[model samples]
Target chain A: MDKLPVNHMQLDRLVLDWMAEVRTYILKEIQRPIIVNTKSNMRDLVTNLDQNVEKIYIEKIKQYDPNAQILSEEGFGDEITDLTGPVWIIDPIDGTMNFIKQRDEYASMLAYFYDGQAQGAWIMDVVKNEIVHGGPFQKVWLNQNLMEPPVERSLEQSLLSFSGIHLLYDHFQYQTMARAALGYRVYGSAGISFIRLLKGQLGGFTSVLKPWDFAAGLILCQALGLQVKTLDGQTVNVLSSNVILAAQSLVATDIKMLTNTSSNL
Target chain B: MDKLPVNHMQLDRLVLDWMAEVRTYILKEIQRPIIVNTKSNMRDLVTNLDQNVEKIYIEKIKQYDPNAQILSEEGFGDEITDLTGPVWIIDPIDGTMNFIKQRDEYASMLAYFYDGQAQGAWIMDVVKNEIVHGGPFQKVWLNQNLMEPPVERSLEQSLLSFSGIHLLYDHFQYQTMARAALGYRVYGSAGISFIRLLKGQLGGFTSVLKPWDFAAGLILCQALGLQVKTLDGQTVNVLSSNVILAAQSLVATDIKMLTNTSSNL
Candidate 1:
């Protein structure tokens, strides 16, 4: 396979077209009976739809650029150990629990990474029919409108979305962070929560998330000038479970202070 | 005014008609600049839209039935100490903070009571344009389709939504309940959260809510045979702030076991 030079406009069109196809396919399939399967635990869920959607993306990405590697939630993509070349990271259905139960709040996330650098990203909120896509080189687009960069807010001036279990256990001093922020919420889906954060509807979001869970959101956050990093301010490793604290820069700093002061990390 | 007889069909039509008008009025008002104001606290919000919408409801109800009384969030309606005669309970905009910030997750909630008995109830999720309305006699409708009674689940099998402050402070021992249930969530609006419960998308919801917050929600729960009460199993008073646990009977029973064992009321 030849090394294909990246073309921003062409990449946008191609990825959007693929996502549109995935959306139509899922919309039809969801109305029928969805075969649900449990993964990791009884509460951790996956559906046949997740597998089928990943298959579709894998086929398209391979055809679009044969040399491009793929890392995906389901095991339908490449087994590359290094980010030494063009790569596609995909979460076919980012909120499988919501998808299997409420049939809402789920999203399809896809992002392009090359030699450890994010190239582009897209998130299609399946139920709301909202698409947010962009990259570091492009302004983020929410549906058809270019999203204005969100106003930065102090930690005390923002609503924070957090994981319930983390707060209950006081992990990373989450309890203190909750009290210090304006208010707290938990919507049960990282993709939906990400949308709320990008819209400035939230101060920040802290959760233990997988690479696919943060892949597209991370790219979009970078494009919009929001901070994305490990809760401890370490660099994000794109292949493992990462404790992410994505927020406006000021809130991120405040949250870091709380976590740093906590006896337990 | 003159001891109006409870007419299920007529009330449904009138309430639906009024709701349609309310929806149109809000859709227009939302597009213009929204004027926000602080209520009891900075987080407890009210908007110009809330007052305007409540005013519209008050005017229409008065014109429709000259003698009917109203107890509303905005002081545009009468203040009655008791739920006697035809009384309309209205929360012009539930989740006003959401309406002001996110522009989603807010709802217009209305319920009718006569001689302290629920006659009809309606909740419109303004942004989603979905209405759930019915009464003790008529079947509940989400848009046009009648909602099937939600399947009952055991506490271990359901998702529970709780107010963040309640859980953080262990109000009602919500932390114990949080650990006892499958998991916990918070959408920040009682109406939106109630929709999830009625659909069986959630196992239960526990919060300290005002009359307007639970009026329509209480009626819908009764219509669907779900349990509505204080965590201590006291009857809900619809004229004041009260602690509420709205859930499937089996789940409610399970949650009661946890609450009963807690030292805090």
Candidate 2:
């Protein structure tokens, strides 16, 4: 087994302090005017606040470790093509649409990678002022409290969360998956949806997610024993956009079976 | 205009106080073992806590008005076939499925009817300690603050909230309804979804709702000038289960046109 790094505790403390500052800025910025712009498509939204938040993370991370490599959503970090030593991944505002529309149900996510392996992760539930952060070396903490590992839930008994467009369009046979589960819901925010899974309140959450979208969630799921994979049952690659399914083991199996059956049909 | 009831303010005050008591009981009961059972189907759930909560409302309402009739999800309520004088409609736990499954998104709802008219309504977003309550003659208050009337939204710019099952099944042409809007969401709780509409956070909410599911929402929608009708655009009968579509006026018109166009094809 790999040992916890000698400086891991210190680094984690610094990240939490930086997050405190980032959160304070976000809480203030939300009250000000939000300037929204679309990327990729009209439905894919970004805001001045997203850029501003990312800048904070970049500045703070650089201040903490000048040699650390960073990857982020708003282009504030290194444009590295591969995960390397002492790498930081940040999604400064994971649910910009929710932030723009509801001013709630959004989060800030960060993850730490070393030598192509995840070492630490953080997801801040911005509205609720709760944080889920930990890594392979530490028990996950939801804010200051230690979070228990999620209990396994079967597909038949648990609610699944998926994007509305994906299920509506029957992407990956999600419509049939919804019917097989207890039910399905979509909050339109990946970070909020992931919180439901971390809390064991959801069976699964499937989405086409970018690196930052799935980075922190992947790390947390690893520590919690939840399954994380591409919808086709391949392991998720942290450096690329993939169709991700995060779920308890049994639910993942059921989803795979449903997908296989649909494909055969 | 119907004159504001001579004792409407006083009655509203009484109901709010009753809600506070009910909220306290719920906050405590959530920590206890929730005794759950299914109704109608496995997906349709009811809990012992739901029954216990309804009994409190029954006892309190009967104590306050001996002649007042009630229709509720639990059998604790009166079995009146018609909307009569001094009738109370209650769904002690509006999102019983969510409550039993997720625990945070559920609410307790109460509505008042007199002489076949929706007179007053209250929906307690239990976990948030927020109450959305009002009637034909009074302004709706979210928590202690008065809520402004919802702004009208066009179909092209607004997010609609509909049940996932309905949209997946092509019920009422919901698939086309989703495609026309900016997007759609399903929180799986009618009262919570209605709260989103009341706040102008969502353009509409559609579902096949029971009388208890929609009675309070109907009263609030009337007060706020939002449209509430069946999918075929008929007025909702408070005494009967119906397929309801509640939305801003212009959005409703857009949906009607879309539904009309799809049927034509």
Candidate 3:
């Protein structure tokens, strides 16, 4: 392996510290009223906290690694066409609707990439105070404990999760795949859903997700020996939104067979 | 109103204490493996904790009010065809599938009825150590704090939840309702879903629920002045499973108009 410019261990520690600070800020801020606004549609919500958290991350990342390119949900970071250098991706509030309405089941996700490859990632269930973080080169950790690679389970014996909108709209035959699984669940947050997937609680998860939404989770899922790919069995482009499937290899294949499609999203 | 057989306050205290004990047991037992079995189908699951929790409630109910008719899931309680006496309804583990799979989002519920009238009801989010309890004669309480009644919102402005099966199978046009709402969520547990509803987090919730599943929630929802009824706008029978809807009155009416049905379930 080639030596990297920045110390990986030092960067990891710094990112973890940033995550802790962000978590504390969110916990205290949400106790009071928040400014909420919609993005593309009524269902796509963004909160003041989301912008604040993204700013915090961007500030910290620039302070530490000034040359790092950034891609973020709230658009607080740089806009580079390619990930040719150190890149930080952020989804300050992955399940903004849940945060604004249910006040739970939302997450903050961040991923570090160098030369278009994952270096480290973190997905924090802010309300639960649990963080699942790691990368392809390191063992995943849930909070302070080492997380085991999830055991592979057949689609028939595993619970599946889908974006509720996709399922309701019958996107890519999501309803059909849902019926084929042992059961279906919708948590509405890609980061939280990824936490469940990494914990072996979900057999598979399928949804149309943006870059920041899936970036952190994709790293953690890959570290856990899970397959992360597009519905058409292609590599997901981290710069664009895609209908993605993250699951055990066997379960992913089963879902593909059930859907039988080619890049529908 | 007529006087009840048992002192409501004292019984409430006793049940609260019992809930604490049950919560502790569940937290401990789930750390290790327990027996898992299926009930009506592969999706309908029951674990040892379910049976044990039901037995705990039954033994305590019998000890205090021996003549009380018990209607419970898991068959640990008495066989009762009518809610004519001092009746206790228990859903030991309301989201057994989630408990067995996700290890979260499940709840334990108990409701008391005197002469078919609700006296008190409790729904405990066991993992979170929070409980929502109260009845028609008393203000609803979420743990130590008094819970305010939920504010009414229109279907388009509120998040809706439904049974995953119903949504996937398009039962009663759940898909249409989902599209009409601000968003859709599926937590897969009636108790957890009811907790969200009572907290004013959800616009509405619709599901096919058995007696035990709806018993405790029905009381809490009614106490909060939210409407609880069948799809056909009939009173929900406390002794049988039915397709039930619980929501703000306006939201409920809106849903009924959308479905335009007459007791299909």
Candidate 4:
């Protein structure tokens, strides 16, 4: 060890430990009765719990690394209009509606960007306490253990999850896409829904999602060595919302089938 | 008492006990490692688990209620060429791909229809073991307890789930509907995915699902006081695929958004 500068192993441990703290806080918050409040409709929701959880994370980050810049959903952190230096991109609670109602299909997403590129991303399944996480050069982990490769599900054998609108509107010819694939589903929660893509359950799905909605998952997919791209197969811009996003390689093969089917509709 | 009807209290208990047994058998199958086989494109999938689970339920139903007919996905049961009598519509695994791949979003669904009208429905979250079920009456249950009334999760405030293809292709104008809802989620499992709708966690949803797919959920939603209809807000054909399905009083509100926001394409 003559040329060792800093211990990379220790840094990894610290990140894992920090993630544990985040998980605990989230679980505690969930255990408490959710105080749901609607934003625009009974469906557009923002619970006090969502705000509280973000506040807790902000406080924790300040103590652990005051120098780290933050971008949060609830506007509880510093203005991070730019992704520079060691920036923490946090969603605090990804599926607010699920958090308020069903208590499942919710996630806590966090991503780190260093020098404007993703360094690591973690998406915690709050109900299960398992994390779909990725770092540079690593297979995704469900909870510290490497997950098995996504099941080799085929389009006819595959099951997909995406917005109901995507299919009903055939905005990207998804209805035709459905005919080529095995099956389809719609959940209202985006952050928590795409686990199938990362795990290789869904062939592919399309969504009009914002940066906060896609950021952590996008990074996690990249880390897992899966293709994460716009529906047109272009790179995702963290600053701009993609018209569509999908799981890579296998799912993409069905695009022709999708387009062919939807055009007639 | 002047007259007595064969102790309904006892009959209810007997039915509950029978359901409990079915639930246990279902759980055993769900827990077992699935046997995934491929077809179509890389996105399609099928599993030995789906066939096995369906077989177990059909056998049990025969042993318990031998004369009842069944409409099932797997060929283990008789072909449901028509819906003329008391038929048990069963989807052994609603989210087969999820079962084979994600192991999370799949569900075991059962519905009984008498003369093309629902008598009872059961939608069980196999992964979580929570069954949100009931029928005929305007009430639903999870396990032993009566479920709380559905919160007013409106389309704008609600999280809606649908097949992503529908929206992408503008099939029945799903994209506009989604823009009106709180958000969207696409899961691979239909029987399992619709649990929220019955429980009142979701405002509503729609998909091109077969009778077995919507049978149980339709009954359960009716009991929960929701409006279930085709995508065009028409009373759906119970024996065929329904283009849309969702809550009752909210139907007009939901459909208006879809039709208004929809483009001719």
Candidate 5:
């Protein structure tokens, strides 16, 4: 594959513009009824809107950079056995179940990375018409104006969003822990819940999410100066599944310890 | 206490007006910084806004009925060990953790019943500024417009919302039954989740919630034409704490089967 020579700025701008296009596709498809397919029992799902949304972006990406590698949920992208070179990791719709069911909490997520380094990312909440974006500028934006990191608070005093399954199945000892607040919450939308984390509503959050799910969210959190990593405190593999993501450096520390008991860090 | 004639029409208007007032209160409070206090370890919360919001409604109720009984979360209402006449059940901030942290997904809930006969109920979604009122109408408004129930899918084809500690800890074997869906979901708020159930996003829902937490929602579901009852297939109690609630009528059969093995149901 031949490499393109656009700097991060040009690429970021194109990605932002591309996000708007994807948002249009999302809104159009969302109002109509969706076709749902099961992936793993009822816990996993694939919607027609997911495929339609991803294909729309991939077609446009090909027009923008014919040589660009695409990692998409719909299998329209590259072979992508590994993450290498200018790959556009697209979830199109990060919270598919929420999209298929509620149509409100779901988000359209897009992440662009070069040589495994995320150059820019976006999580567009379609119903709300807000795209949370982040890049080298170290800012998160709804559109134009920048967003601040969440209100400073401790996990013990803040609301936490965790996959109730993980909290139950993972044996994190969270059940016995003193951290459960009266406000302990769960949104079930990784992107929307992550946005809430950045907005200062949740002190921290944890969930078994996919790469396309966390890609845009990671950039948004990093831009807001919060800590994010896999449950084991390892750098997230943008190609894998079952990753747990969180906010607040403090909350991340406790989460890392709880989820990965072997890690003394 | 002197028993006076119950004015159904007047109380309906009062319930509607009081709900509107609390909706405004929620909007104003959302903008202010939240002060979250920890309760029941760090997971449960009791925010200043929670208490304040409850206080406002308590005072209003007192003025309206003068002799009407009240049960509220913030200790601002009343105390009676038994079901009484024309009592008002209120959960000022039904999703307090969401209110304290997310500033969205929370509701100001109130249910009025005359000696246990359901009369009126309100669930005002704060951020959307939409009132899901069903006492007088068959339609549920998302904002200014009416909302149709989510596509009429079967339980196996729906997305669920049940995230109480009991789902995993107490071993909710019925998980296999609800898991028959396109996905299994959990939210932090029983009140908020039940309203979503009314939206038909989930084919059914089950949650262990308090009386105040579900009284208004129970009345709302009844008004919206959704099947709602305690998990045991009994009508809900307006005064006693309810351990389980499901919106779909079919769910009643399966969930009851799951809990029948244990006397817990």
Candidate 6:
């Protein structure tokens, strides 16, 4: 393991304090007029609120750990190629489109890694004013309460969250998987999707996601003994964008079996 | 016009007070165990709370208007083929699956029609504790404040609410319609979809709906200058199940053009 200036508990406390401040700023800022700009396309969006939140997190991280490497959605963080030392990943606002349009169902996320392994993670449901946070060093929590492990159920009896684009275009046999499940929901936010999974409201979720979008959620899901894998049933890389799947082990097995059979034909 | 025992304002006050009682009952009942059962299939659920709420509305309606007819989801109200006299439509819990599993995004809706014309309507977003109510007799209101008309935008610049079953099965050229919008969301409840449309968060919604499901929303949408029609661009009959499309006039025109072109091809 890489050596760090502060211990895991100390780093965790610092992150919690920053999140509280960030949440207050977001709630206040949304009441005022916001400036929005498109990123890769009209469907993809970024807002001034996203940038300001990212800047707040980066400044605080730099002050506490001057040498900490950072990877983030906005360009304010470092250009990171490796996760060899103490690293922090930030998604200032995980669902920017939802933030700009609906003003709800968005989240702020942060994950800490040491020697390419997760040390701690935090995800805040900004509108609801609650956070689900923890990692390997400490058990997971929803705000001040301890989070219990989600109950596992069969795919035939659970609600699955599949990408709306994939369902419409029939990519990766998503339509077949959806038919096998009890029902389908599309929330348009990965952070909110993970929150539902952690609460056992959803059996599984599959979507194309970036590193910052999945980093904090991946850590929280793993700590709860949920399976985190690529679409082809392989482990997920912490630094690259891929089609990610997170669910209970049984549900994952069922999804893979159903999708593979349809693809074979 | 058919004569009635009471005027529109008196009936509206009675429904509003009943909704407040129903909200308190549901919030408290959910804290305890709920009895859930299948209606049409495993995916179509009805709970004890749903039945109880429907009974509450039925009793109150009968007490207030002794000869009033009711069309309801849970079979607690009267059955009539014609809409000649005073008729009340009630959907005790609009999204029963969401209520049983997610504990949010469901609603209780009621509409009053006399001589086949809407007098008033009310939909309560139970969790949020806010109600959107109004009709031809009066303008729309969100809680205590009057609602402003939603801004009209073209299909390419707006978000849409669509049924997941239709998207997965490729019914009615839904995939084409979804592609034309800024994005797609599926919340699984017509009442919630209507609330989003009323708030201008969604530009349009399309789904297969029963009378109780669309009655309240249709009245409120029409009061706000939205177009409510069948998939083929015909006016909706307020008494039967149909594939309904509710949207701003510009977005509706674009959706109809896109779907018509694809179906012809």
Clashing pairs in 2: none
lDDT of 4: 0.68
DockQ for each of the predicted structures, in order?
0.66, 0.78, 0.80, 0.35, 0.41, 0.67
**Chain A of model 1, TM-score against the native?**
0.94
lDDT of 5 by residue, A36-140 (tens): 887866567788878888888898888987878988876778877765777787887877767766777878888877777767788877778777787645357
Compared with the true structure, what per-residue lDDT tens digits does model 2 show for residues B1-265? 4464336778888999999999898889889999899888998888988998999999999998889998999888888988767899989998777898788888889999888877789988888787899877778888778888777878977889998788889888898989888888889889998888898888889999999999999999879889999989998888899999999999999999989988999
Proportion of native contacts present in model 4: 0.58
Give the residue spans of candidate 1 off by over 4 A.
Answer: A1-4, A261-265, B1-6, B261-265
Tens-digit lDDT string for candidate 3 (B1-265): 5376766667777899999999999999999997999878989888999999999989989998889989888987788977787999999998988898888889999999988888999999999998999887767999989999888888988888899898888887888888888898998999999999999989899999998888999999999998899977899998898999999887897788767643354
Clashes of each: 1, 0, 0, 57, 12, 0
Error of 2 at A228 (Å): 0.6
lDDT of 4 by residue, A1-265 (tens): 5133223345445556666777777677667777777665555577776787677767766776678788777778787667766677778777676777677778777776776867667777777776777665444676767876564545666656665545555567655566666667665556666665776756665688767677877777777656677877677878667865566566666664466555677
Runs off by more than 4 Å, candidate 2: A1-6, B1-6
Fnat, 2 decimals, each candidate: 0.52, 0.69, 0.81, 0.58, 0.52, 0.56
TM-score of each candidate structure, all chains considered together? 0.95, 0.97, 0.96, 0.76, 0.85, 0.95
Better of 2 and 4 by TM-score: 2
Candidate 5 docking class: acceptable
What is the C-alpha lDDT profile of model 1 across B1-265, one tens digit per residue?
3254866877788888888889899988888999888888878878889999999999998997899999999888997899778899999999876777677888999999988988889999888988889877787888788898898889988889898888887777888888887678878899998988888889899899999999999999889888899878999989989999999999999887776767655
Kindly give the stretch of ten consecutive residues in candidate 3 chain B with the minimal lDDT sum: B256-265
lDDT of 1 by residue, A1-265 (tens): 3244577656887889999999999999999999988888877888899999999999999998899999999888888688888989999998777787678888999989889888899998998988889887767989878998788889988889987778877787788899888788887778888888998898799899988899888999989999899998988888788999999999999887766776555
Minimum summed lDDT over a 10-residue window in model 2 chain B is located at: B1-10
DockQ of 1: 0.66
Clashing pairs in 3: none
List candidate 6 stretches off by more than 4 Å: A1-10, B1-11
Worst 10 residues of 1 chain A by lDDT: A1-10
Judging by lDDT, tell me the better candidate of 3 and 4: 3
